[model samples]
Target: MIDKVIITGVSGFVGQNISRYLSECSFDTEMVSLRNSDWKSNLDGIAILHLAGKAHDTKNVSEGSEYFKVNTELTKELFNYFLESNIRDFFYFSSVKAVADEVPEVLFEAVLGNPKSPYGKSKLQGEEYILSKQIPQGKRFFIIRPCMIHGPGNKGNLNLLYNLVNKRIPYPLSAFCNERSFLGIDNLNFLIKEMLQNKNIPSGVYNFSDDEFLSTNELVQIISLVLDRKNNSIAVPKSIINGIAKIGDFVKLPLNSETVQKLTENYRVSNQKIKAAIGIKKLPYTAQQGLEKTIKSFIK
Candidate 1:
């Protein structure tokens, strides 16, 4: 059992939620942010879950260099400090993009990592650093590469979709067909807690995703269900939508090129390894159930 824990990026969405869960379970939790402050010596024997890093910025090209600095360089610094400080466990939250931009039709643990974006490359660099290090006796390290994580308070593209659906705005994405795996916050929390307690989970990389995959249309339906609105989606031809997105890009309109790509892209990550290691068959929530819960939180 972990008595003391240090959570980096505790102010962010996932970090804040996980910290609350740990605190409620009677673990002594300390919040740390990369933006400021020094660590207290009291964290000497604690387990560290590092969640702080530069998220992928879709709009800006220059932010790629910054991603490398914060994601790769900062992680190296923290790992070195943890090794010297006698920390027992170190959990690094990486993204699935580190492995692949678009999950192959048949995903597996041994897939060759070919990251297209700088965000993915930066995370891959961080994972490589951890893998290259020699683990001292009594120390365990984990590199968790979770797919698109969504739940209450998530402020990304998922939230934007929820807002549009909730407001009964017509969706022009029905023509697209893509299946993507999403990680619910509750399931992710369960896996993290399992890692904290289970010593047998080998110190290495693990991929995570929900059991059931949902297409974009299904996701929008779940959002509509949560909002008690009619499931109204138009099957706008792909060519038309693409034209609109192109125009929106130049006009600086709301549904710009980036949003269009996100809606149409398919990223289906596999979580078989994590399930086998943790010895679980199904997560606590279904795709629709988890999504509904997330949407309901926004209404309240």
Candidate 2:
């Protein structure tokens, strides 16, 4: 049984969620920022869950170097500190973007990773640095690559879809057939607890996601069910939808081409390895149930 843990990036979304979840599990957690300050005093015989670093800016306004400075360099700094300490497990939170930006098929950790964005590249750099090191005896390292995460606190793109459904607006891109995977925050919490306790789980790269994949169309239907509204998805043609999304670019409309691709993209991630490592066939919650819970949070 794990006794204590030191977590960085305690204020961010995942950080806040995991901190609270771990506290509920009755584990003592020390929260800290991933700055250049000396954080050794807090590292005395505690596990490390490094969740700090700049997140991807969907607006695309951030500089490329900023990703490296925060995601890559800061990770290296904190990891070096972890290596010097007696921390038993070091969990580095990475993204599926580090493996592949356009996942045309189900993505696994063993595949050739070719991330497209600067954010993905920087995260890949961090993973490589962590793997390049020689871990001390009796210490385990986990490089976690999770897909898009959502829950009550998430007000990202998913919320926009929920809003359209809630307001009874016609969803235009219903015709586009696609499959994407989303990770519920509760399932993520469960995975962390398993990783912390199961010493049988080895140290290496692991991809995290829900057991099943859901398309944007299915997502719309789920929202409609949760809101108890008549489904209003219009089967607009792909050409027309693309044309409107193109116009959205100059007019700054919500359903722009980029967002349309995100909504209709095929980015399915496989969670087989993590489950096998933890000795589980299925997660605690199904994709639909977790999504329904999140949709309810929107109403609250």
Candidate 3:
């Protein structure tokens, strides 16, 4: 078993949770910031969890170059450093966005990556850069592409739904039926634990997500369940909603085209390969169970 692990981007939501989880699992963790100049000197761990990167900007305000600089270039730098270091295992937290912004069918590991947004393109570049390099003997690498992750303190699209439900506002896009996969923080931590302990798992790209997918309608119901309130959803016509979304594209309306697509999209990701490699049949938390935990945390 690895005695210690190094994690980057410790200030972010995923990094913080992973650090706490690893501590709970009796593994010492050290946080290093890539923004700092001397970060390379502090690499003292058996494994390096590369969690630092430029996050996808929902508002579309951030510069595209920023994504390449932080997501792509920084990853290359750290990965090169890892190649030279004594660390045996390196894990990069890539996003499913690296594969596709819109999944027509179930997304598997072998799907060709065709990212649209700058964020997705940058993440894909990071993955490609790592894979292009040749690793020395006795070293392993992992590129994990996780779907929408939710947990306590994560403020994203999920928070938007939660706030809408909390305020008794009816979900407007229920008519546009779609299902999306979600990655529970606990499930992610569980996978990391399995990978760290088990030596048989191969080095490659893997999708990290819950076994089941959930629709926005079901998600509203989940929020209602956690709040102990009545579920109120409105099936607004898709045409009307899309019209408003187009208007929102120009205007600063809450129901923009981007938000609309995010709320209602078919993005089912399969985790079979990772599970088979890790030798696990099931994750510790179910979809409903994990969603409920996240909703309850929002309430508190």
Candidate 4:
């Protein structure tokens, strides 16, 4: 029966939505500074939600060590305080990137691999540190690794897809078809409520994702339907698209090798562990349904 909650990083895209949800649910929510130099009065009989961390910079512009300074070091400090406090609930938001860069098959909880980016490595470091700590009988700790989370107010790669469809521009990378998983903010909120209410849910690493995987082609169709337009994407040859992406990388165009890979990748994540722990067979929203809501928000 967790009531009082303290959340860090309440200013982030995901954090803002989470704060609103908690308030509507009648939970006494408090926002804390991630840059707090002292943790003396921060923990009192309340649930702690650690969401402050350096996000992944897609443009490859941020300093590599900054990820460790915030994501790793800050997490270690706050988690240590949580263990000593009277708080019984602690939730750490991690990412699927902590496991692998490319998930050719289904991503599970215990798959070990080398992370390609500093962001993923820093998150993994935080996860390792949390797992090493010992928890008392009543206290609970959760390490959640969510997939590509998107919904209203998400101005990331999904916005790029919306722009292309809204303008009737040709999608050059239509040749590469693959399945990618996404976690809607709606489903994430639902899971958080479950974690707070149900003390039976054990503490461990869990992946958050929607029920089904949606392909890029399906996403394009969904966006076109939402915008009342036709998808004018052409099935450009694979070799030609690769060459174009290479040239774009050198010329600093919109389509680069890394962006191309992100747009068309086979990263499928399985949510069996999370659903099992939550005692459900399906998430609250399907992949296409969640994407439809996100597209509507874009037009709003």
Candidate 2's C-alpha runs over 4 A off are: none
What are the models' TM-scores? 0.92, 0.96, 0.96, 0.97
* Clashes (N, CA, C under 3 Å) per candidate: 0, 0, 0, 0
**Number of the predicted model whose lDDT against the real structure is largest:** 3
Clashes of 4: 0
Better of 1 and 4 by TM-score: 4
lDDT of 4 at 203: 90
What is the TM-score of candidate 4?
A: 0.97
In model 1, the worst 10-residue window by lDDT is 37-46
TM-score of 2: 0.96
lDDT of 4 by residue, 1-300 (tens): 548888899999888888899888888788888676664574575588889999989877999999999999999998988887888899999899999999989999999846999999999999999999889879999998999999999956798888998888977777889999988899999899889888999999999899998889888889999999988888999898899889998999888788889999999999999889989988888888888898899999
Q: lDDT at 4 for candidate 1?
A: 84
| Tens-place lDDT digits, model 2, residues 19-98 | 89998998888887656377666565457898998899988999999999999998998889888887889999999999
Cα distance off (Å), candidate 3, residue 145:
0.4
Off by over 4 Å in 4: none
